[model samples]
Target: MGSRLRIVLGQLNLLVGDVPGNAAKIISNALRARDELKAHVVVFPELALTGYPPEDLLLRPDLTVRVELALGEMLREISGIDVIVGYPKRQYGKLFNAASLLRDGKVAATYFKHRLPNYGVFDEKRYFVEGTNPCVIDLQGVPTGITLCEDVWEQGPVEQAQNAGAKLMINLNASPFHKNKGKERFDVVARRARANGVPIVYLNLVGGQDELVFDGDSFVVDGRGEMTQRTPAFVEGLYLVEVDADGQVTPITGPIMPELSEEESVYTALVLGVRDYIGKNGFAGAVIGLSGGIDSALTLCLAVDAIGASRVEAVMMPSQYTAAMSLEDARFQATTLGVKYSFIPIDPMFESFLGALKEEFKGMEPDTTEENIQARIRGTLLMAISNKTRKMVLTTGNKSEMSVGYATLYGDMAGGFAAIKDVPKTLVYRLAEYRNKIKPVIPRRVFERPPSAELAPDQQDTDSLPPYSVLDPILERYVELDQSTDDIIAAGFDEAIVRRVLRMVERNEYKRRQAAPGVRITPRAFGRDRRYPITSGYGAETKNEPGGNGPAGGI
Candidate 1:
């Protein structure tokens, strides 16, 4: 048993469904760590072969075969250094999220993920069958305990490894990012390390896969539950961590990297999420309707930053109610950012729509119909540009608007990606400010102005909804915190406003379901994060029955 051992927690980024590409990444990183760093072994994240949560791609026979072949290739290529990698292993008509220990051009051992998180953003139960064994093997004569992502989180597998005389635990993960997710990981790893009386290497996959963004904050903790090294979030690279038999980890000295701030980390996560989504799907560019509002301005900035300014186009679709300052601000911001800007008035289109519906609405009062008509007209024009230019339309609705149905369906909600759909209005303003801090990209006037849709004359958002300062917190409590109407009201919110907001949220379930994929910064986003039935009688109306609505309320 050598006291000197090198382990590389290969926190690498993997593209979903790219079996060959992902396999190449795994082998490349392993070789780099083994040859260049002179590490004894390199470990990859959970399901690194087919990419984490291959979603429905696992159902394809050809894709599964491709993944299996790639896995075999990885196993056959590497020899000198042992490789601990995660991949899908098929056995007896069941798919297991398993990790393989490869040495001397063959798989030495394998371990399956035990805990399949079926709640919130996870759907592992729908895809994988759980495995019930602790994968403990010898690495350079040191006992190494292998556990897949979710397996390390629970007690049974890690405890079983300790009971089986394992000394070090290596957990491969493809964990997704959610605001303070890194902190959660640190806490969990610390607890596990302390309880197991052994060091743990927590490695994760980084990159954007659909709405989910995995932040590779791969870290190491000693037996005393002390963090030794950490890789930065929202980026990809080989993080080399050396562990001793005494259960201590120390960073292999090279380029000393500065860690990102919480705000910067989250901000970069959103940018990368959007960048990968656009780039991976092969969109020519992104088209966003810039209304000189905070949400649209922030979205435009992110779009330009994600892909170059040349790749982004900002269109101003002003209706009759649009203010002159708004149009100017929109133009100013777009030009300042070097993004292509275009203005298309919607009054003519509005008139045509009104004429078509004139007889039907002959005696009815003009209300949200006019507002929605303006939205639909803008949506149509954006879609037209998108269809012609092969650019993806970018929706700018934030979580605040999305939570209460403030956005118009098939109108402002029309896009291939909702860049800021998970961000709340208050955070939207903060992000706008954050963007401006680097360089004043968004016009100060845009932030100073009162928020409005400008769908109808003098239509301010505050006219129909509570102030975002008030609304966002309440929405966060109710939506993210899953607070009841009574709970929201107990938090000092007006009962009537809480009820109204909850009602709006419930009624708009259909719209949210149809909305495009968006970056999820919050714990619960509109996409896969929050799953609710569209055609449901279940509202705040059902009570304390776990997954049932307790009362009738709106948000």
Candidate 2:
């Protein structure tokens, strides 16, 4: 018997529904692991062949056909080393999330995933049937158990594997990232390893899929709940570990990646999410309407970092009321970033709209209607450029503005993707400063100046809403945490201000519904995470029953 067992963990970024392409990558990587690393067994993440959360694509008739063909291809091409691969299995007209152990060009054993995660971005119960049995196989002279993502979260699977005489365990995962998710995952995995009294290998998928970003912080833990090996976050690569004849696991000494601070992790996630979204959707490039404010400046920086400066275009559309400082800062940022810059004065377009509506608005006083016209003109110009260039417009509305309906509909809200839609206003300033620490790309004066829409004379964001320092926390509690108006007021916020902010958020569901899809960095984003009815009497209920604690009365 071999004295040591060599295992390779494939932490990969895979595209969804590309069965043949994914199959090719698996075959190539397996060969590299077998020949170069001499790995006795190579492990891949859950649903590696089909990609994570394949969503409604699994319901397609061709899915099973394509998956079968890909599995056949992998089996025919791979040999000389054992391969544990995750794929969807269609048996007896039912689908099960499964892992197959391939040895000598054939499947030696299989393990089906018992736990189906149904909350927060996972809907596995909609597609896969629950698996019941624990599978253990002998490698060299030791027994190894297999489990899928959610299986390890519960106690049964790990205990069952140990009861079945497995000396070691491997859990495959496609877990998504939110803030501090890495620490949470480690705690859970460590507890299970100690409880089961076996060293376990945890492999996770890494990439951006739509709104979800998976950070592949894969690692191995001994029976004592000690981490033997840890891979870095937000990248793709192969990690290795070894098991001795005594079944004691030792990690190959590589760089034990340092943990990123909260700001750093979030910024990296945004960049990765933007890159994958643009690349996966095949966008030619990105275009931003640079307002020279903190929001647009930060969004432009993210775009440059995501897909090079050459691929990003910055347009400064200064209306009559636009500040000189605004133009100066916008120009400086575009020049510093080396992106293509254009100056398009919206005066002509603004005057044209006012002229057309002059007679129709004879009886009405000048109001936000005129301000919205300025925004709509800018939106029209940006969209026209986007259409001509086949580039996506990256909208720069932050969560603070988006929450209280401070943004104009089809104006600042118009874009293909909203990079900072989930980012609150206070955090925007911090991120800008963080970027500057790496290299000062954003202008200092931009941060110094008070934020404005620059549509009307001497306008400021505080003219209509509360200051962001006060506003962001209130919004976080109300929108993200779903706290009641009474709860917010009781938390030391002014009662009137709390009521006003909550009312604004409640009234703006219609606008948010029509907005573009953005990268999600917060616990509760506007779209998938927080869903509210647009046309409802809930706001009235909140006003009438300010002290009530239920959803309708809460805020």
Candidate 3:
């Protein structure tokens, strides 16, 4: 009873709705931990059985059948180690988020998650009911409490466990990534550990699930709120943690992994998100439409990093309007990255299109109608290549462009995945700089050049939209924060510009609804995270209510 406890933390990246595959991995990890690591108990993330956010898959009756089949296999195979894992449990004519202790070939103790999160990418309340009691299990001599993701955010579950005389707490999570979420999570867990005088072992699932990427910064904290071990973010592995229990309190100790910087973390999230989305969906490779601008250039780097330069292809479909510098820069990066590069001129095809439409449109000045034709031509070509090679088309549009009505729907936005859809224009430049720091792949002129779609003669993005420096903040306030028009104006933004930006965002709901899925690096992304009606006549708020200056950072 005076011996130390050795627990293996399984920070895994699991696919959604693959119940049998996930359970197999769980059993395999448990056996490995017992044999190689010599650990007594191995813990997994929340909903680890069927993967997190199973969504509507939870409604299928056959899902319960598959789960029971997986359970039967685990009971037959799992032994010599205690596997504390999470799964969706069906009981009493209801479903609850539940976890159980599989020790010595039996379910020793089970715990149900008391809190169900229902905001911003989580609809747990729709799928699961609230758990009332705490399930405390004895690992050797230590009484450990089990809680799911949202339970740690609130105080009640951990407090109830503490009242039940839990010496250690294990909180399983499928918490997704957003900007600076690592710090927010650590602060929350550390505070709870200190306040309740209970050591906490926090394990989170790591991988991209559609728009959400869970950065696995799993760690263990002492009763005094001091972290003893921490795993690196955006990685999948089995890490070991040791705790010495003296019946007074549990002291955690192990090797700690370093946390990533802001730019580093966001960039890594982009790479992981792209990789998993492609690999999980069974795409062969990634095909990016490379422009000489920073957005495409940065996206190219991400693709090469994500899959590899050999697997990535760069296509530069230049038009008469595309600048000479753009052509040079795009070609240079493609050669430098050593990817398959092609320069397919659109002049001949574009001319044919104009000739075909000549009778349909007479004496019409070359307007955006003509500009859009060029984009559509490029989109057509890229999609054609994607169809032939099975390489998914990766779009180059950023959040700011997508936020407003700046992006062409069937044109530039035509791709399988948008790596930086949640990233703003300002952040795009920063990521370009971040990538170049490792090795200067993107040309200097690419960053310095004025951003344009290159679909028209002598064009610039600023001609149609505000400067990203100012535009990004306004979009963040209006789109992500839901700040009223008056509130944004009060916080040092021009009223007219604010109103115009609001209108653009509101009018473009239909476009965003059809946009491709991308990584969510911000608190609120376009799809799944932020849902707004496309046909709503609900006007943008212009309330005069006093809400002072919004905090001046998120860029």
Residue 399, candidate 2: C-alpha displacement in angstroms = 1.6
Models 1 onward score TM values of: 0.94, 0.95, 0.96
User: Candidate 3, 20: how far from true, in Å?
Assistant: 1.4
lDDT of 3 by residue, 1-555 (tens): 667889899999999999999999998988899999999899999989999889999999999899888887998899888888999999998999999898777888889899999999999999999999998898978889999988989879999998997989999999999999998999999999999988999999999888889999999999888899999898898999888877566765688888889999999999999999999999999998888889999999999999999889999988888899999999999999999998899999999999999988897777777887888888899999999999999999999988986877788889999999999999999999999999999999888877888777788888878888999999999888989888999999988788767777777788889889999999999998899998776763522223211211000
Off by over 4 Å in 1: 1-3, 246-259, 540-555
Q: Whose TM-score is higher: candidate 1's or candidate 2's?
A: 2
Residue 295, candidate 2: Cα error in Å is 1.0
Pairs in steric clash, model 2: none
- Candidate 2, residues 245-291, lDDT tens digits: the string is 45454333444677889888889888888888888889989999999
Ten-residue region with minimum lDDT total, candidate 2: 546-555
Candidate 1, residue 369: how far the Cα is off, in Å: 1.3
Best candidate, lDDT: 3
> Of 1 and 2, which scores higher on lDDT?
2
CA lDDT scores, all candidates in order:
0.83, 0.87, 0.88
Off by over 4 Å in 2: 247-254, 543-555
- Comparison by lDDT, 2 against 3, better one: 3
Give the clash count for each candidate. Answer: 17, 0, 0
Cα RMSD to native, each candidate? Answer: 3.7, 3.3, 4.2
